[model samples]
Target: MSLRNITEHTIALKDFQVQGDAIKTHPLSIGASTNRTVNGQQNPVIHIRPGETQLWRLANIGANIYYKLHLPGTRFHVIAQDGVPVGRAYAEDTLLIPAAARFDVLVQGGAPGTTRLETLPYNTGPAGNQFPRADLATVVTSGTPVTRAALPTDLGPYENLSHATIADRKIVVFTENKAGTIFYINGRTYDSSRTDFVSTLGTVEEWTVRNDSDEDHSFHLHTNHFQLMSTNGKAHDPTHGVYDTVNVPKRGAIVVRIHFRDFTGRTVYHCHILNHEDMGMMAVLDIVPPGARPRATHSG
Candidate 1:
């Protein structure tokens, strides 16, 4: 994987509308719509010159599906995970679309055959979850709805390359019981908790993501990227190497290394399922400047 010819592109969210009516019954679901454009459209398409090494900044805005971002006929050398650039390479097919997760995928464009950006359901399906009245349920215990299409892309500006060391890390614990199980980070629920992990800006931290749910959950962060250190207590693939969004299988843990840089505000980390997130599967991280008065940290 090389970066000699990678050009940047922006992925906007557009052509989207509220999905199901059944969504209304759910406490935190995105209510019904005739043709609602929820997240933005106009996702950036990366065009890599043949045999060129280019860098791309990939971002997501609220679309809650997992995207298998790839350049068919071409392979990408991962230069960065999330927002922090790395010195290694990793080949990937499915890029997790966790609200604000970012990745720097280096690729040389393929043979010009409609490179498809696919979004597949992380779990089994969304078919039976809908009530007769058309309200969308947060959990799809039955099957996937055929109407679902490609997930949206949310891209943002790239700040100066980020680099920091791990000051702290923790596992986002997601435990729930329902027709569709929701998630929680560190046993704290989303929206209700507001803040989950707090870090000092300019500091690096390693987060170990543990997924103890019956279904898969895509854990995403707001302002940073992480290196694929280990999964299930083993080292992640370093050749087809590194990624920003990772799919944590049921009953496993993926360890990620990240650095906090640039923006410092109330950033979010959550499950990409927009409904799940809105229903309480999300958390916030605060990036405070170093040597400043420290806030009380929580670990449970």
Candidate 2:
């Protein structure tokens, strides 16, 4: 199910030019594709046979805001993340989904009853907006029961970067002005003509990304996915797989390892919050062929 947040107020052309903080206060109407109702309206329902397992491909395609999804009394057997199959499946009662992230999971129908698929209250940070709880859809299991399908123990092999030799290491810092009107990476607003980072193809590099602002930022990269190594000095499980977008906590840091393979060209790394990107929390990244000299001057 694709999830998105719609604005309750009329979106004007000037809205697109607003700063990130100003955009945060806009009223949101969050809903799923199958059932797009808002504000106390009856939610669309899905009927399932009890004990039957179904694979649900969920994607958060919204531009801003986060979804802390919960389906009480059931667990989601997550098999994939961001469309990439994980090394192994894991179960969780609540799934914290950021914008642009996707997860494929196996959900088994519970006893005959109606339950609401809802998002819990999520407070990003003191400088961020607080999203209230809302129901996305309803799941009703009332048909004849069926045998439950066995969950997969393993999905497939994933890139394990634990023992790989790192070619280089870089640091990225996220910051913003006190007014939150303009955002920056490494203290510079995004300049399309400027190449902020340059790397070589066929190389693995580690990056330590720090967020110095008071709000959370979702860091996203183009071209290549990255495996999270640690968050705030805490190591992550190798099986967590790779993702193109990950959250960087306010005033905290995260470590990620990226393998620049195959493709080489100019792309970008940015804060996934749409308004933040519009306001300047982005930088250019150019990946050149191995042994090829970089064409443009870079900040780092």
Q: Which one is best on TM-score?
A: 2
Evaluate residue 233 in candidate 2 and report its C-alpha lDDT on the 0 to 100 scale.
94
Error of 1 at 290 (Å): 7.0
* TM-score of each model, paired residue for residue: 0.57, 0.86
Quality of model 2 by C-alpha lDDT: 0.78
Can you write out model 2's per-residue Cα lDDT over 173-246, one digit (the tens) per residue?
A: 99999877789999899998889888999999999999999988999998899999999999988786588889
Taking the tens digit of each residue's C-alpha lDDT, what string does model 1 give over 156-199? 33322124344776766755555554446666676533456677
TM-score of 1: 0.57
Q: What range of 10 consecutive residues in model 1 has the weakest lDDT sum?
A: 131-140
Q: Which stretches of candidate 2 lie over 4 Å from their true place?
A: 1-42, 298-300
What are the lDDT figures for the candidates, one per model? 0.52, 0.78
